[model samples]
Target: MRQSPNDLTPGGQQRRAAIIDAAAQLFNEHGYHQTSTAMIAERVGCAKATVYHYFRQKPEILFEIHDQWIEELSAHVADTSDDVPLSEFLRQVFRDILQLMETKSDHVRVFFEYYRELPDELRAVATSKRDHYERVIESRIRTGVDTGALRPQHPRIAAFALFGMCNWSYQWYRPGHELSDREIADELFEIYFAGVRAESPASP
Candidate 1:
């Protein structure tokens, strides 16, 4: 029987992870436009054929990286129950995304840089996963509006704006510097909610 990917031996798994890590860093630093499979293999101390054994092409490696990122973000969002209050849930969601961005900064950077180079089919899959994440945020914003915790407005628009605010942080966020991720999330939440929530239930 053919072994599943998860059935790989420990050393095999470690080698695969190392290759992915090296590829992601190269793609991030040099961009997919400038990076090559040979560079990836060199960085990982593996034969070029070894990298090909795992990924058919450089773009395929990028697709895998993006797929893994989406899967992880989806899992995190899925674990958050709707039973939580909207405000708190939003807080959790923001913090979780920020943490993901921080942990996968290199991958995220490469994703944004090379996403356009993915084949049409792969791009569709990636776009759908991205849309799903946006929908999750929009759903929570809609819930907040329904519960009187947020102002009544277009949920999709609010979700997009909110996502943009948080996603753009990847461009400027620095680790172990001035602000912690939690502190940044808290400040952003306060600014976002204060402007969006209805005041006194009486304002025109």
Candidate 2:
């Protein structure tokens, strides 16, 4: 069984986080199936038994990575004010996501690539959170549509397109590239907004 946060000492909490960090790097370098608990322990400079003390199994570590990544993103989105225009909201959210990809590349990789390797029960948790995140995006799109800020279209489809543009950047985006992450996010947002923006009335 995983150690409960309520029970863990401050040091214990740090150790658990260290284990997750080490495991994320290893998982990104070597496929999850190829990476072993022993490798994670070695990377963290702890014994394998110590890793087991915090997590019951390898899949638990995978779940931790996915859970933390999604929670961070969800929290950021939640903080955004409803008063902000959808265009501005998208710009902010996309930039935040790209910035995270720049810093937490391994975590983002595990989120996108290794989720299916999780056990059925654990996979369900990831799926549920992901579904909730998508719903949040769809809700914003729906609000934009109702307010006439966005064109009349399927909110769900619009949300997926937004995710596609933002999330897929983990595959190709690099820090210190010719275009900064913010620049890339802004350019992509413009492409998305152009398709969805409501048309203005004709001039006399």
* Candidate number achieving the greatest TM-score relative to the actual structure: 2
lDDT of 2 by residue, 86-173 (tens): 7788788788888888878899998799888889999998899989988988998888888788888999999999999999999998
The TM-score obtained by model 2 is 0.93
Q: How high is the lDDT of residue 81 in model 2? A: 85
Best by lDDT: 2
Cα lDDT for residue 150, candidate 2: 84
Each prediction's TM-score against the native? 0.91, 0.93
Ten-residue segment with the worst summed lDDT in candidate 2? 195-204
lDDT of 1 by residue, 1-204 (tens): 122348888887787778788989998788787888899999999899888777777777888788888888788878987777677777776787677677887887778778999998889989999899879889888877777777889999988878877888888886677878888888888788777777753311
Q: For each candidate, how many residue pairs have backbone atoms clashing (under 3 Å)?
A: 0, 0
